[model samples]
Target chain A: MKHTLSVLVQNKPGVLARTAGLFSRRGYNIESLTVGVTENENVSRMTIVVTGDDTVVEQVTKQLNKLIEVIKVSDLTKESYVDRELVLIKVTADGSNRGEIMQLVDVFRARIVDVAAKSLIVEVTGDEEKIVALIAMLKQFGIKEIVRTGTLALGRGPKVIQSGKD
Target chain B: MNLTGAKALIKSLEYEHVDTIFGIPGGVVIPIYDELYQQDAITHYLVRHEQAAAHAADGYARATGKVGVCMATSGPGATNLVTGIATAYMDSVPMIAITGQVTTDLIGNDAFQEANITGITQPVTKHNYLLHDASEIPQTIKEAFHIASTGRPGPVLIDIPKDVQTMTAPFDYPKKVHLPGYQPTYEGHPGQIKRAAKAISEAHRPVIYVGGGVKISGASEEVRALAETILAPVTMTLMGMGTMPADHPLSLGMLGMHGTRYANYAVTESDLIIAIGARFDDRVTGKIASFAPNAKIIHIDIDPAEIGKNVRVDIPIVGDVKRVLQKLMPMLKQTRTKEWMEKVHTWKREYPLEFEVTGLRPQYVVREISRLCPDAVVCTEVGQHQMWAAQYFSHRHPRNFISSGGLGTMGYGFPASIGAKIGRPDETVFDLAGDGSFTMNCQELATAVAYDVQVKVAIFNNGYLGMVRQWQELFYDRRYSQTKLSEINFVKLADAFGAHGIRVDSASEVAPAIKEALAVPKPVIIDFRIEPEECVWPMVPAGAALNEIIDAKSGKV
Candidate 1:
């Protein structure tokens, strides 16, 4: 099964590597991960997608929490949460096919973020499935380049995952 | 008054009650050494090799339950401590390893005598720090010691740059550390304890499988109480040997690859396995899928990471072993397991460990050591000698037996014995070592004699790397390539180093030599000429089922 975990860790050099090192050393499977600064400058939040059984996920959560840099870890798999991934894809759109690609982008509710003499750069932000689907549709037109930010997540409503000190 | 970072570091160590430091001085660490020379609060023991310093500190901690401290200079010095650091990490020994680094400006420039010690030790340490400023020295040192001694207890590293060490800072060690991420759970959950207690009371064929955690948490008494009340026989892992009295009727000597036949049988047949302070290592489990096949496991460990790391735990209680057992003991109902006890007794009687009596048996040497130094803190180097000591030495207290359990590092015993002697001067300390391992750190004999550490080192001189030779004889068709060792005149070496030395070639001389070595006022080395081809028996080849053991003595099982 797939589990999403939101981990809060102290802002410091090598903290990300150490947190990720635990997962790799213990052989825990990580599907996708995204880390960025949080509301506080001294803290950073990491949203990791892990695929394992109940026991494996539990061990990962506990092990992550054991790291000295990590302040808090929560498995958001069973909770209501919004997850998003942003992808910038450049596809061949010279002349005749430009209108057709723009039409497809409009249908998918994505926007053209950049334009080149030979191609158009489409920006899409949504859940993994929507981003994946948009990428698949754009692949019909020759894809020149693609970059994706791995999934980031937040819980719904007033529930906030805070550090122990906070 | 403002003090240099090096002085502040020393002050913080004093604040943490660290009186002894095992370290070697070098270029980057000269500033700290200069400051140390000016202070009388902490005594320093100079080691020939940085590795031995770490091992000695580990021995001190294991023997006395205090956080051991070791220091080394940059580059080669810091790298040399890796094996010992990993050794302490594997066994969960509480240790603080401080290394002096190149100046901050030259950190990544590949400057002379520079090394990224923290980066190198990342996986082995519980936590590590590289100071960015001089003022952070006191708090970092406090945090390092706290992390090293608290919770599951493992080695922590602090790498201080030379520039930072020379910078001036106000010395004020923090009274308490505030690490929001590192709080350890000490008390077991009430519902889980109740469940565990109920399960123990109801278990018919129950076995308490003990591990090093029992000793680490000082929970031997609590374990004994719970075991006796529930009438469960105890089988301990190699690291768990001294956690309970070895002579106790319920105690099943060391269990694992070289574990006894009956202990393996009992575990296989048991209905409930109460695992305490032990992660199921591959050596202990043989084949994980088949280990304790009929048993439902109740694992009690302080580290949540270890609860299901290797084995599937049916009931997991995450807490300090001592605290968890103390709470669970009262909730448990006393019960008798007469039928199970009878079966276990029969197995024990039928399959006692035996060896041919013709030549000088290593087991006899170990037994003599135990008899002579009954209260001694025993340390061992890795290999066949370690196994024999684990099997034969009768340990009466929790801290009595110390060895390189987790990492199984060679050449650990001698220096560790020195550390143990320093930690507990009132008690005798012995290093049961093999010729191969003794040669690794025998240079430390000078350190011992100079300081009068008075640790007895008994070498099992088989003229070969006995354990590797055994593997070759059994599995590789007796091709002893590089197994035979070049000879050394230990007695002459000891004399040159100003220590007592005795060599015995026969079984009759074993006891007398040990007696003589024990009476010596200074450090002593007794070299015993053991049978070259002797192998540890009841061997379960790696990955084999526990029951499929090779009993070469009788040529029968």
Candidate 2:
């Protein structure tokens, strides 16, 4: 099972290493992780996607909470949450298939951010499933390169996982 | 007042009421050592090895319930402290390890005597800091102490660059720390406590399993009270030794891999396991699935992650053991467990801990030491001597028996005993060591002698790594492979260090040598040449279930 966790931590040196090192050291499976500054400049929010059962995920959340720099951990897997991952796929598109690629991009509501003589870079932002589906579709067009922003997640409602002091 | 980071560091330690430190001076730490020289409040014991310094600090922490402090310079000095730090972290000992790093500019350049200590120690330390500025000293030191000594206490490291230490800053130690992420839940949930209490009252064959957490939390009395209230037998894990009086009627010696047969049987047959301050370690739970097969477990620990890490916890109470026990004690109703008690008693009587009385056995040496110095603080180096000490010595108070439970580091006992003695000068301190384990840090005899820290070390000189040898004999077709240790005349070694020394080859000479060693006012090492092939009995083979324990007669009980 996949569980997405929202972790708020102090935006200090080695906090990321400390958090990431924990998962590696404990042999916990990390599917994806994205970190960015939160509403407060001093705090950073990390959306970590981990693969584990309920018990293992619970242990992961508890262990993450144990880190001194970590402010809070909210498992958003069960909650109604919105998650997105931005991906860029540079496809080998020449005059022959450029129109077809643009048509496919339009149907998927993606943008052709960069165009070169032999390639077109399509940028798309959506949930993981949508991006994965778009990538699979672009693979047939001979994808030159693909990059993903992992996953960024938030609760669907106004429920916040921030430092209580804030 | 304006002061350099080094001075401020010393000042912050004084504010924390740190009376002693175990450390070794090095290139990067010279500035810190210079400041230490100007200090009168903290007495620093210059240890021979950086590792010993950390272990000694850990020993002091275990004995005094105060945060133990140690220091080392960067690179090799800092790397040496890794094992000691991991040892403390594993056992949940409160410790603060200060390391002097290369200057900030050279941190990533691999300058002279440089190491990224914070990065190296991240996996081992509970928390660590790499300070680049002088002004962060006071707050960092305060937070280091606070984090190290708080809930689920463990080792915390603060790495100060040499230039940072030389930089000047205003010194103002923070009165209180503001760590929003580090608040430990000291009180159990009311609903969970009620559920646990109800389960305890309903259990007819309940066994109270205790571990190092009880000692760390200072909950020995609470554990005993709970055991008495519930009329449950108390079985201690290796680290839980000294948390409950061994002679108490409810006490079932140490449990787990090398645990007593009765303790294993009791846990196996238990209807309810009231585990306080204990993690279900693999050593404690032979085969996890089969461990306490008949029981519903109530795991009470300060660390929530430990609740169901291994065992399936029926009732999980995340709180300090002392506070949780206090809340749950009143809600408990005593159950009638006469039949269960009789069965446990029968197992105890049938599978008593015994060894052949023919030769000078290591167990006999430990027993004599325990008999003579019943009130002494006992520490042990890893291997056969450690298990024998755990089995033979009777501990009656928290921190009385300090050994590396989780990491099982060799060479832990001697320096640790010195630290233990320094912490509690009134009590006798003994290090039950094996020849293989003792020589790892025997250089600390100089530190012990110089400081007049009178700690007795009983070296079970078996001329082989007895524990590994025993394992080979039983499981590996008796191929000894590298287990044979080269002999060293420990008496001569002790004499060279200006400490007293004695060698006893016979069981009859053990008692007299201990008495003579006790009379000496300095460090003493009594090397006892024992049966080379002796093994710690009541063994549960690796990966074997608790019920399949092999007894003294080599029969499955």
lDDT over C-alpha atoms for residue B152 of model 2: 93
Model 1, position B75: C-alpha lDDT score:
97
Q: Candidates' TM-scores?
A: 0.98, 0.99
TM-score of chain B of 1: 0.98
Cα shift from native, residue B537, model 1 (Å): 1.5
DockQ for each model:
0.70, 0.82
In model 2, state the lDDT of residue B489: 94
Q: Model 2: per-residue lDDT, tens digit, B1-557?
A: 89998988888899999999999999988999998887788999999999999999999999999999999999999999999999999999999999999988887987998888899999999999999899999999889998999899999999999999999998878888899889999999999999998888788899999999999888999999888887889999999998779899888999999999899999999999999999989999999889998899999999999989998999999999999999888888778888998888898889888998888998888889989999999999999999999999988877899999999999999889999999999999999999999999999999999999999999999999888998888888889999998879999999999999999999999999999999988889998999987888889998999878886676412
Poorest 10 consecutive residues of model 1 chain A by lDDT? A157-166
Where's the lowest-lDDT run of ten residues in candidate 1 chain B? B548-557
- Tens digit of lDDT per residue, candidate 2, span A1-166? 9999999999898899998999999999999999999889989999999998999999999999899999999999889999999988999999999999999899889999999999989999999888888889888889888888999999988777768774
Instruction: Indicate which candidate wins on lDDT.
Output: 2
Per-candidate local distance difference test: 0.90, 0.92
